[model samples]
Target: MSRIIRNLVSLALLLTAMSVQAAPSSFDLVGPRLSVAVTRDGSTLPLEWVPNLAEGDRVAIKLDLPAGQSDRFRLVAAFLRGAVDRPPDAWFHDTVSGKTKGGDLSLVVPKGAQQLVLFVLPERGAGRNAIVSAVRKQPGTFVRAVQDLNQAALDRARLDTFLDLLFRIGRQDPDSVNAASQVLTRSLAIKLKTECLQQPPELQAACLTGDRETLLFADTHSSALADTLTGAPVDLAFQLSATPQGGYGSYSSYIGVVRDILRLFGAFQSSQLRFVPALARMGDGRLTLLLNTPLSFAKPASVMVVGLPAIEAAKPPPLQAAAGVPLLCAAPDTVLPVEGAPLVYATRYAHDMVLRVAPDGAAGFDLPVHADARRGGFVLDRALPDRSAGATIDARIAGRWGFTPFDGPRFKLSDPRVNRWTAAPRASLVVGRSNAVTLTGEGAGCIDGITMQRGDAAAQAVSWKQDDANTIVVDVPLDKATPGTVTLTVTARAPAPPVSIVLPALQEVGRIDGVAYAAGDESAVLTGSRLDQVREVRAGKATWRPGALTRAAGADRLTLLPVDPAAAQVLTAGERIVADVTF
Candidate 1:
């Protein structure tokens, strides 16, 4: 096994040496493989995707199998495009029976092997397994592009977020920031009394439930009692605040209240730090998540933050986001400031954009943000005015921002407000015939590509035109949908080198095509073209879902029985593989 893995790794290195950040020399990468061919004899199972090997060089093989099904098959790589004899299984499995699923596996290609295959029937009962999907990860045209697109959305988000934080922080209005220290403390102390109590108290059960002010006092310094938070009651958590030896005096005073903030919610900073739930409020228009990590004399950084509220808030706002339920105001006009002596803020990405807000209140973003500036950072009308104490920065930025793809093209897609990188930016779709939708990104030329689908049917790009430099309108022919699968498109020559766009799944509201059984002993080929096997052929149609059937549902033939004799009569047939619904 070690030798086999080593040989595969060596092959990848060899390919890299021959090419620049790309796939192997002789092979080409193929798209996803959801279909499988299981020979009647079960001697071999060939994937829809064969390793690309029109050969200019040598090759090896890699395979990924469905869970708990690896033992049912053995790996074999083909050579000479079948001109020469194929090699044996590259490595031997401990299980003589290929029935259990193993993770991804690789094999050594023969000196002349160009493609890969699997011998499925190691044993008689082994025909019950399959491969979910496989790609040789070739070094070709789209490899780098796809990798870039993957990170593009993420990069855009960080950059936009960084800009949003910078611009919003510049507008900070400290005067509007009312000090809630006393109010927060009293509220925390009262809330704590209602939800919690001290263990081994000198008083009886209801003793400390009402007089929350005293309970707050008793619990605050309960170092004798404040030892462990392991006593959180159901739906309630335990929190305590302790003042370090040298700390902010008033800030130290409310340490207990702030401690609750540290406990209930996550920190405003990096994922590395953790914070508990702290309650701030949705004051009229502003929705805030407030937690003040006390800045000492040494680290005297103090600034308030206004974050997008939780997806679902405890109470509704006057202006609800989606439903009547109140949501975090779309984009709070507040920028995030680095929490240190010298404030630093940058896009979430490692690179792209960075802004330095000097403590003296001067702020500068990496690029001049002009509203109509194409290919520039988040657009602003004019260069920002330097801000000072309590500046009220309303960074009203919007949409899914992303970075540029690597080594691909000069084109970039940002400002999700108008052109988002997501598949379903519209958030809704209708199925039956075809549906038209727009894709947002930055590219040089007219869009010449699209990918779409509804239910079992796939969609094709019927017509497309460049809406502008940043937007392209593409029409897709959608099929009648039950639940539309995610539709993706690879638009060639958008900004030039061609880019792929994955729209959100066009969620279709339609009927379910469940596999219902007829009464009696029966064996029939399932309706679909390429199905291997299904775990349960619905015994009775009792609220079944697609998930009820596992991935190995590639087998064409299925055998089923009725859950009840009455249901048997309702279904009447042995195997109703095909549906009788009107199209």
Candidate 2:
């Protein structure tokens, strides 16, 4: 044989091998054969739909369950007409006949349909994830997506048909759709249930829509679970103290959502959902005022924001015509510009919307935060304009219209929140006599582990517990400390796209030199160059906190004051030494 012929044959074989390798693992087998090949344990599922019903969009279902797992589980699907209501029976394969195209391998539906069904059947291991690949490619599969606030595009990252949200105050303007549109955006149309202008104070978020089959559900105004967090028995105090702007990192929005979920489980629950400030100005010519939440809301007509009489009484910031760039700031209290102002309004309450993520949160989009597979979560990092470290405002919601606030939080033409992140991230460590080491701002999602090695001293297993998701307290053994400084290190974990950050070794603080004082003592003076910090101090049987410290002589003389008088009780000499210092 000629060498040319041999080379040609080898090239042909290589091409054939590559093509076979490129074929997708799953395939569609839709024809007359109802009992086709089980196809490697139902790894991939193919489906189709044609508009055959009366007055709604067409629907289809595909399943890819493990072969042996669901031997008796037939494909059954159902939907929720409202937030809390659903039909008793599910539509089976018989309800909707299926037809597979002969050679092309496609499931064909009937004709002239108007209604569609999004099955809420997680138990079936079917629906969206099982079929979105083909569905997104199909001509008209009704993609489950979220439209951008700019209305320029839709985000389909998570293929869910709906999300739970709250209803806030609304407004009336030529471009009012932009406000609610901030939270209400999806590739598919949505019906938001929000507060209308029918009454003075809109307290509820349950207004009936015209469609008897469709129900709008949302949490009411007092939805914040702040009270529940205060007495949170769990060591989730790290989650409680975290500020929304500084602690949560990219998943700040997602953490708030998870915190709200924890709130529902906490002993005390509230109907109030937390609200964030949103600025929508697409550059048209009008301004629309709408309160924003991370959750989604629909009902454009029902969403309205009416400032209480107190908003006007606060002497809010004045509205200046085209005053620099309209900057939105989040203040502790609610304030707003006068009518005809082009700003947004939102009040600040101690919502604790911010949360601590693992140190590896930066890579959360891709890999697991830890090598041990101990945790998993996602981050919703919404970029904003000017992070002043004091406030945050996402301007993507800013449309072309002018937003006029009747009464709400103040919005100026010059507030800042973009650079806030530049100086936002900081690391802190508080040490104490109890040998408790508190890690602050250590991780992005969750603090996974801590190790302290004093020179050659065996990498001691310091027992620790999470004060919150972002903070952890590693209680070193009483014998671990000496009179000199020591080096300590930690590793934090966030969700993937995998990120792990190791903080610089923290230098230890030397022993405190002070007059002995009982835990019940109100104050104690220490003359030393080293001061140990602690989050909690226990004296006698009660919990006491060390208050602000005052130093004088060459920064050596220090005074510690106990703030909790209730914890003051007669004690023994054993409690006369220094207690933990609360930061």
Candidate 3:
């Protein structure tokens, strides 16, 4: 096994040397059987399984090596944070000269490390810097290879768990089995083929244990799959076993099927059949998804959109797309195609739009690609903005070979007021003072400039500074202005409309005198500064709204007719008056 692994590594290195553009094949990398055991929080993961790593994780990597050839080679482990390679000194190194057929190296996963690369070189060949330089030349290939490795490891773990579940279901009593087993027997079994089961007496015995190879061939090569490969209209089942006349072929040994499934998953993780999801705000302000595909494979045979749980969910619920509730968010048998031209594919896919997660339990929508004369991509609908935070959408595209799943775009919901105000700049402002106000809300950071205009006067420049992501400070000069409305037009960064805030100025309205209600009087007399500015007045259980203010020569006075005349007329010292006044 070690010799085979060595040869595979040699082939990979040779390929890299021959062509800089050559992708590091996962097949070659997988042969090394690079098993990593991550020790985190005092617990060590099982061998050959690699989980997502966090900071402060200590990883133990064991590599199989050819016996006599060990002395001639050195294993270099490179840790990467995205495309940025870690310093050469931080990389792990081990000389493969052990008496045993295997060598082990231990290292902390390190802060911000998202990828790991392991390769063997001649002990005397290139120095560490030289190796680093080569990796820098094609960082994307190495990064992609690492992602594929991690995904393959995770998929293998899942497959093992699935097999374990099957074994448990067989060994345990029907009543004692778990919900997962119950789902398999009650819901999943109906989708299987009766021929595979062979009849009632042998249903559990023959069907549960079937030939994987024959089953895969039967399902994958069916008429529906053939139609899909040829770009014909066919409603194909998303899973292998769920297809018509198809089942997990009664595999005598489960190893072959598991390998096949892992390989399939590996291909999905690779860049070979590239599919990327993006978010776009159209001219009409519609937020959409841009499902970018390579020009060579631009037209997918079929596309399906799956609504996912809040992206932050630690464990998302299993996807169950029945016929009516199609994950595609369309009626059954509906065939949606890519809606952009090849040139649009070239121009649009170049963007670095990343997928974001929507809030948990947020509503999901279908995002299909679209294009016009000037712009082209998936146009996000209004539903996206309405969704709660952390919600995520996903998609599956069927190519000539098989179905490949990709993540859809995400959104962070914002107040709708931000949209209308930016274009017209209408918000309330107070007069007779220079107001230093801190504006805090969504899209506050987008405000690059602020201007204050009183009535029809020329726009006066205002000094404003961004304090944080959601806060901006603006100083409005209104001390000289008389009581009236002022429009504060706020300018956002390019592409966002400027918002106008219309401020109707009113003098301070809080001054108060005694409120008196004579037994024979028709209403109570309330006196205060800016008596006309008070919209409503509340005292004890009695609430009063004045029709209009009638001011005397001495003071501003208003007669308040209580809405509830039968309630208590007396006002407490604490609750003597609570008025709603506009500025």
| lDDT for residue 408 in candidate 1, whole number 0-100 | 9
Task: Estimate the TM-score of every prediction.
Answer: 0.20, 0.21, 0.29
lDDT of 3: 0.40
* Model 1 lowest lDDT segment of ten: 337-346
Model 2 TM-score, all chains together: 0.21
Segments of candidate 1 deviating more than 4 angstroms: 1-191, 195-241, 245-363, 366-418, 421-583
lDDT string for model 1 (297-408, tens) is 1221121211111111111111101122111111112122111100001111111222222233445232222111111122223223333311212232222111111110
Error of 3 at 521 (Å): 65
The lDDT of each candidate is: 0.28, 0.27, 0.40
Count: clashes, candidate 2:
82
lDDT, model 1, position 164: 39
Lowest lDDT 10-residue stretch of candidate 2: 369-378
